[model samples]
Target: MIVISSGSNHANAQTSMNTWAGATAQRVAYSTSRLQNRPDSAVTRDVRSALWRTPNLDASGIRVRARLGTVTLTGWVPERRQISLAGHAARSVRGVRSVSNQLLSRNSR
Candidate 1:
């Protein structure tokens, strides 16, 4: 005859449950991080498009980086207004949480 103890069965079940819970938590975390980056990518694209549409702002020299919906603009512009213009254009994007304008003026030196 085969005999199975209840306590042993309970402990085995608990271990399986814990393992499954850990795996599920990891998957959720990975999915959340992946989804979060999508918006930031879209924000970068939208900011670049906005700059291209604006006049007198040369977007070719501008660099746009986005993380967690915040955008950092780095590059050179000919005038001070162009800096403000770049910031404004970045802010206009829907997914942009904030803007860090670091544009340098060519004549500031």
Candidate 2:
């Protein structure tokens, strides 16, 4: 009886997986590449989100600007290393064509 129940469950799972796959096949995949066609404001938001997600990077004071695919980051980070990290993060966003990192370390500023 238990074996029969497990087999039934497996069949249901497979059916659900197929349904989900079929439903999602035509759905858009949200990733960095999708941001390429987005506007500058959208690019700015994506860059800001990227900086906030970067490890060991303090983004509390960071300000992001985007213009014609050019990104400018201004503000202060807790550490000098975070400046480079912020730049890299900004550049990784798909819509960013260039980065002007103006981040100053807290101690340096």
Candidate 3:
């Protein structure tokens, strides 16, 4: 018996592996593999590119680094909202296992 859990009691119900739901689950697993195996260099470039693309956030002073798929954002922003925006931008990039937002608001200066 094969069971796929989707956060409900019925998730324990057995289903044929040939079902459409099974196919969807397989696709999700494949995508997860891609996320786990991304190179740190690629992840860093993607995060930096995303930061540059995000509007309303002046990422000029921001520095992005990636290690083992975990991205760290550091430096300063003009406002508190920009800090959150910068973190969001980093998190949105593919292959980012996690984000450590260390950006400081100008108020702290």
TM-score, every prediction: 0.62, 0.64, 0.66
Per-candidate Cα lDDT values, in order, are: 0.85, 0.85, 0.84
TM-score of 3: 0.66
Pitting candidate 1 against candidate 3, the one with the higher lDDT is: 1
Best-matching candidate per TM-score: 3
- Which residue ranges in model 1 land beyond 4 Å of their true spot? 1-38
lDDT of 3 by residue, 10-89 (tens): 55444443476779999999998865657889989989889889999888889988998789998998889999999888
Q: Kindly list the per-residue Cα lDDT of model 2 for residues 1-109, writing each as its tens digit.
A: 1123546887777778887886676464545456546698899999989988999898999999999899999989988999999999999998788999998999734
In terms of TM-score, how similar is model 2 to the real structure? Answer: 0.64
Clash pairs, model 3 backbone: none
The lowest-lDDT stretch of 10 consecutive residues in candidate 2 is 1-10
After the best TM-score superposition of candidate 2, give how far the Cα of residue 92 lies from its true spot, in angstroms: 0.4
Question: What's the CA error at residue 69 for candidate 2, in Å?
Answer: 0.4
